[model samples]
Target: MLDVLSEGFKEAKLKLKGKAVLNESNVKEAIDAIRKSLLEADVEYSVTKNFLQRVQEKALGQEVALRAGKGDSRVAVSPADHFVMICKEELEQLMGPVNAELNMAVNRPTTIMMVGLQGSGKTTSTGKLAKYLVNKDKKKPLLVAADIYRPAAVQQLKVLGERIGVPVFHKEGADPVTICKEALQKAFDLGCDVVLFDTAGRLTIDSALMQELADIQSATKPDNVLLVCDAMMGQDAVTTAKSFDERLSLSGVIMTKLDGDARGGAALSIKEVTGKPIKFLGMGEDLDRLEEFRPEGLASRILGLGDIVGLMQDFQKVAEEDQEAQALKLLQGQFSYIDFYKQIEMIQKMGSLKDLIAKMPMQDMIPKGANIDDRELTKVKAMIDSMTKRERIGQDNLDRPRMARIARGSGRPVKEVEELHKRFTAMRKMMGMLGKNMGGLLGKIPGMGTLGQMNNMRKAASQMGQMPGGLGGMGDMGSMFGDSASKPKPAFDREKQKKMRKAAKDARKRNRK
Candidate 1:
């Protein structure tokens, strides 16, 4: 994740806090933070300079305006919020307006030649791209093993092709250009809708490599020439893109290893430096993890508002229609350990838990750098497996004797088992309250009600199985092993709760004026 860039935006926002309007003095301090972040992220010198200049111009003297709310409820938003909006827009303008589509939309048997520096994850990206097209676009793809220089490159492509049920076209002892030339006919013969050429790459850009790539381009004339770059390369990735674009005339870029702690400068710099869009991002090693890059979504995440739309999209991808009905049942307080087990499986397919939280509007509430112990999911599963049939469904009383019996069977301590039961009971109680007045809870959160609002209530409700309290109170409704304990717990004694209710009632009565 781009933690560096996100941290910079957060610091900039903090610098502008309590200010009535943007001034040169305050704006300079905020922009200095951004400038330092961008440079530290390895963003190109010229691109960083130009981007900061644009942001400063837009933010200077900007005025806070009342949010577009109805009646007397409208309130003025802060100037820091206005500055973030400007930054998000400028960031989007810098990276995109991307056409995330491959050239195969109109062209039949579309040929896409993959090129990049060696060790840039080009071969792996080619395989992932094929799987993505097949899954997302219902494409019949032909993978051509044209990277003859690398050892086992052809075999690697063959393995990937076999795994995905896509055909691999390669000549056992031929040059890169000839292999690609023949694969074009193989695609036509096999009736493949697309052909991807996994071309040879070098340790560094060289005359020989460029000439080979140029030769393949002349012969095959691919509709899309994508350069797969490692996002961890930072500034070097931008340089690599420039060199390849000069020789091969690239159509797009696929950034790989974005799941790692890449500074994110390369992703921001490539488009500005070389005028190419990053069409796809390889987030993880999972074959299904290739994602279409969204500039506005990325920009919003950078500003720490989180992308609720993106979060729902991811939820929809891993959830089936029937699961929506099940989720509705769970949301209505008909939860069970069986349902919890299924959700754990669904979330495992969704990738890292921390990344999922980053897309949430309330991510800041969770302790930063909290080491989430995802292995706890497996431990929970083991504990559940040891439960009796009745206990697996729901336990009327999880007494110490039963917990000790289950802990012994699952090879876990009694304290661990008791903790798991406590979490489940807390969740069960919360869901019961939620099923009664989720709407009221939605309206109570300060800024989040607007930021995390959704048009599709069913879609949002369906995500309850994947996550709890999708609307608000995200810090308290945490992952199975998240560090939510680090957050301050509220005093919830009966008298305290009664006093809080009275305070809320009095505040509402005062609002009538």
Candidate 2:
């Protein structure tokens, strides 16, 4: 997501590579690239300056040189890698430690007060947090619609409550403070362990708005006061966090719209500038897309190292609770179109493919021009729906005629249907290979890498066409995603291809003439 920020660190790594050791001149050259990137990303100047200083200080320190060519992990660390390690450690330090999760109370009915500027996604984040509590934390949560100032804010919260199966507490013609106080009683009646107050936001922070929030906070005495800042707000998000922290003494921050925020200055800046932990990151508009903020994973992603742990967590969220048994069954070779359909659903629920790929170290293994389309799942589903019951259950494997029928029924090309079937066949074999080793992988997510499962994945990927960096190239990802990367392509002879195409076009023109 932070492409610009990543490019900076990548450039710095290139600058330091093949060097005997870190030196002030080379380090400064690398830092200059990083400095330009940070400023371009809209990071706060002070935070950027301080972060670079910490990174540079450690990079040139004696420990880095001593540890050069050695690593705590299995792999050896080169000078360039050691330098990047310094940068990564410093970046993680700057972002602060992981919040673990929302700070809940020992007693029942933990109150979480959500505050932010208007249009900052306070209400949506409240619903997402409630969904997180329900799905991940397995606790009863009540959504409090205390944003009475904005028109339809209560109704909006009600819709979200219905969507997430959480109860909404709102009073007609009641003030925000009163609504919050009464919502506590409702939570008590409902036996909800968590109560989230989606407090009213303002176009701009003002005395009257802050006073209203202060009144609610004073009355309810929330256990957590989270300020939801829009990531796209950049430095202004930092400013908003500052203002809110000063007024309400915020417990933590929730950064929203990170999926759309390419620069990611706010996410990197808010924690350092405001001295608050980023508890969760709001990735997309989906209620289930709120991710717990892990500084280590984020720092890795920002430096283009990829966050395998985070990627596993995303997979765990989608598959652990509802689809664990199903996923395991499919992995055990009982897979069919019915199960493949569910796989597509799980992938869709896991959010965007591009974002998922961004969290993988093998992201570059994808073909350079490959386009990972989320809508491809819908198309695959359409094709599956066109098949008969026997075909779906894998009792009657599809022949060419059957595939043609499905293509016509689904309004797709026959080649696409054929490709789907081929990819599905390949995946069925791969899953059969992985069935034994990956039995409990879904349940052990976020730590699956440490559980000796990455090797299992590599083995599974090898059962199909192996890619350079593992994960079975685009063929396996193609099997999962049904994207253009379903087949690995040879590196092109660009000039040869260009000349051939030009000659063909000229011959066609001559024939026409």
For each candidate, give its TM-score against the true structure: 0.85, 0.81
The runs of at least 3 residues in candidate 1 whose Cα sits more than 4 Å from the true structure, single-residue gaps closed, are: 66-73, 105-107, 395-397, 436-513
lDDT of 1 by residue, 285-326 (tens): 877778889999888887888888878877877886597678
In candidate 1 the C-alpha lDDT for residue 223 amounts to: 94
| Clash number by candidate, in order | 0, 0
Clashing pairs in 2: none
Predicted candidate 1, C-alpha RMSD: 8.2
lDDT of 2 at 3: 75
Q: How many angstroms is residue 415 displaced in model 1 relative to the true structure, after the best TM-score fit?
A: 1.3
For model 1, what is the error of residue 293's alpha carbon versus the real structure, in angstroms, after optimal superposition? 0.8
